[model samples]
Target chain A: MKKNDIIVIVLVAFLALGIGGYYFATRTESKNAKVVIEVNGQLYKEVNLYEDQKVEIETSNNHKNVLEIKDGYASMVEADCSDQICVHQRAIHYNGETIVCLPHLIMVTVQSDEEYSVDSVAN
Target chain B: MSSKKTATFGVLVALAFIFSYVESTIPFNFAVPGMKLGFANIIVLVTLYLLGSKEAFVISMIRIILVGFTFGNLNTMMYSLAGGLLSFAVMALAKRFDGFSIWGVSVLGAIFHNVGQVAVAMLVLQTSALIGYLPFLLVFGIISGVVIGIVGAELTKRLRVILKV
Candidate 1:
């Protein structure tokens, strides 16, 4: 194999592991932890762990999106507009979990005391 | 470009849209949202290698605009444009690298696309927190880019033999 091919192979392997690791590290099963919702850096509401309820998060853009918390696992159930990307997001159940709806500037995420920050790409 | 080349490019654009729609439908359970195989990029890759940078840019732009409009994703147009442009520029630069092939160019393009999209997200949301997802996106972008690039390169090889372009 060419040197460039080897480099690409190594790069691909490193990326796969990094991505896989990030996903596993950030993911938390909603077994015992409580459900918390935050918007625009404020604690909006917290879903009671004991109840199976659907939380409707109304964003500033007037778009209504729903998060269903059943038995502690929280996932987006429905969205008003097309391309329901948030609705398609994996269920997040941890502090500092975030699902951003760009059109609305609304971010629905779980919050943990731990800070989870990723790097920004140069322009 | 010759009439024949123009017609070929048109066909490539159509193929890109078809692949885009097809890939968009095959759902995968990934951790990140809005992540996909982006198989349609194969056409763009092939175009870049076979035709030239400028032609490939036109083709990529046309594909994004057409697909976005058809899907009514006006909000995502900016993100897609930024990502696509950055990717194309990266691929063009990759062409300058020693012994660079279409595959290398496409992979670089894909990585740049992910970076560009994430950058847009951070700026639009005015939050640096979203940067956390960049690594994963880059990793996936490279894998997907290479796969699409391989397909594009293989097709270009066959076309070079058949069409003698």
Candidate 2:
């Protein structure tokens, strides 16, 4: 590899590592994790992770997302959206993890018992 | 372009379409939504090196459109167009630079491909939350890009000898 090739490779690698480290470092730990479901940014439902339940959420008109809470983890079991992004996302149990179905404007976030702190500086 | 060259591009476009269709048949998922091995890019790389940028752009666009119509929706077509255009532009530019091999060009092409897809995702999602996926996507893009680039460059080298171009 030439000098320029090395430079490009190293540059992308370093940038990815730096941002990845920052992401993991600032993650908020959820002591008592709860599954928060929002439709078009409005709170639709909240469920405790400890409980096992299958919730069928209808958000933004006819869009539906089926969320399953099992064994202290929340997963998007099914969805009627074209993207199926939320369904493809792995189960999220930790604090600050989210499964967002963009086409349906449905956001599933995991929140801890701690009070909400709006930190706008992360962007 | 001459009729002969046009026919050649048409054949390559068909080959590109086949590569895309073949990839879809494989049971592969990286756990990242919309992530693929991008094997279709091998055709893009080869077309760019042999026929030039404009032909490469045409081939890529036609391949995306054909594949999009076959197995994907309108949204998929939009993302494919955006990603294909940007990757082709970056690869064409990288090829113009001196001393950077086809491998390097392919790597750049793949990275920009991810960047382009992310840009479209941010626009479609209408929220910055998905921006959190950038770093992870970049890491994946780099590794996959390297593999695709090496394979693409080797194929290009072999084709050059076989085709007597």
Candidate 3:
């Protein structure tokens, strides 16, 4: 292989490794802490820090949803829709982690009302 | 172009569009919005190798727009468009470097696709907080892209005789 080709290969390899390292290192297991659920800038529900608990959410639009936070591992236990994306999410026990159900527009996060971080995504 | 070549291109676009539509129906539904199976990308990659960058790009864009219309989600069009364009651009650029096979190009494309979407999210939300999620998306993107790319490359190899383009 040419010298330039080797350089390109190394660069791509480094980039892949960097991305992989960043992903694993930043993963936080919030298996045993308070869990908060919010919707449209409103405090909707809060589960006392627990290893695992099934919390059901009833939306204004007449949607039934369940969030399970167990051992700091949080996930969507159940959902009203055919596609259960929330259940697939790993529990977030970090200060700024979130699980959002775009179809239902429901956002389950680990932050409190006092934590002012960001607003809704545009479009 | 000859009528035969035109016909082949038309057929390829149709196949890509169908693949894209079918893929949309497959519910990956991760809590992370925009995360998807992207199985239809196999067709795009195959087309890229068989027909070259220009044709592959056309096929990719056509599929994206067709799916966007079928889904009828005007709001999400921006995000999809941004991601698709970014992915294709990265793959095309990587095609220039030696030893960067189709799989490598696909992984790079996937990485850029996520980056584009996240960039859009950050701009739309007017906050950098969402940027933190980039690492997670990157890891998944690379893995999925590699898998899909392999399938696409294999498919292209099989079709080479039939598609003499």
Candidate 4:
């Protein structure tokens, strides 16, 4: 690679590392984490992580996703979408972590109750 | 296009198409969603350096549409189109500006490809949390981009003499 190429690579590498570092550093593990499920950008359900339950979501498009919350973690155990990408994503327990199913327009995000209260105050 | 140019474009497009098929079967289970080796980009890069930006754009578009029809649905096609379009645009701009090598162009294309997909994902899901995926996708893009660029550079060199373009 040429000098300019090296510059581009270094710039992108630094940028990636910077954003990644910030994300990890700011990650907070809440004592009362809640799993928020959204379908087509609307709140479908919110469940406590300690509840240990299985959530089955069926979108209007007839898409299906099975989310399982157990041991203080939330994960997509199964999905009927062709890619099954959400199923392959890692289980998340920390605030701001997400498992997204693009085909079904499903998003499973972990949010701490503190953020919920903050939203309430703002509202 | 002349008969020879038409034949060459056909061959290039076919090669890109096969790369897409091969990529789909590889089962890249990388934890992070939307992570792809982007093998088809190698052929697109080769086409860019060997032919021209216009030819490369057409070949890339044809490959995406053809692959979408063969192995994927409309949703998949839309994602691919976003990635392909953004990637090709960045690569073309990089090439036109000069200074950076093929590797740089490839890496930029790969990175922006992910960015484009993420943009669409954000709009579809209506959540900014998807930005969390950028770091992983960026790192993966760099790795895959370098590999594809290496192969593409070699192919472009050899094809130049073979095709005498």
In terms of TM-score, which candidate is strongest? 4
lDDT of 1 by residue, B1-165 (tens): 689987888788999889878876777647675465878778888877777788888999999999889864776888888888988887877775655677677777777887888788877766666666766777787778778877887898997787676
Better of 1 and 3 by DockQ: 1
- Among all windows of 10 consecutive residues in model 1 chain A, the one with the lowest summed lDDT is A114-123
Q: What's the distance in Å from true for residue B83, model 1? A: 1.7
Better candidate number, 1 or 4, judged by TM-score: 4
lDDT of 3 at B71: 68
Count of backbone clashes, every candidate in sequence: 10, 0, 13, 0
Between candidates 1 and 2, which one is better according to TM-score? 2
Q: For candidate 3, write residues A2-119 as lDDT tens digits.
A: 3443344456557657855775587554333457776544678777655457888887889988887676656777888644656676667675667766455567766543323223
Q: Per-residue lDDT for B14-112 in model 4, tens only?
A: 999999989888888878987889999998999889888999999999998999999998889999999999999999999999887999999988998
Candidate with the larger DockQ of 3 and 4: 4
Instruction: Mark the regions of model 4 whose C-alpha exceeds 4 Å error after superposition.
Output: A116-123
Can you write out model 2's per-residue Cα lDDT over A38-111, one digit (the tens) per residue? Answer: 77767899998888999999875787789999988889999986556668788887776777776676778888
Per-candidate DockQ versus the true complex?
Answer: 0.27, 0.44, 0.18, 0.83
Q: Which candidate should be chosen as best, given lDDT against the real structure?
A: 4
Candidate 2 CAPRI-style tier: acceptable
Off by over 4 Å in 1: A15-52, A60-62, A70-73, A113-123
Ranking by DockQ: 4, 2, 1, 3
lDDT of model number 1: 0.73
Tens digits of per-residue lDDT, candidate 3, B65-165, equal 87778764654677778888988887887876545777777777776787887787666544455655665676677677778877877888888977775
Best by DockQ: 4
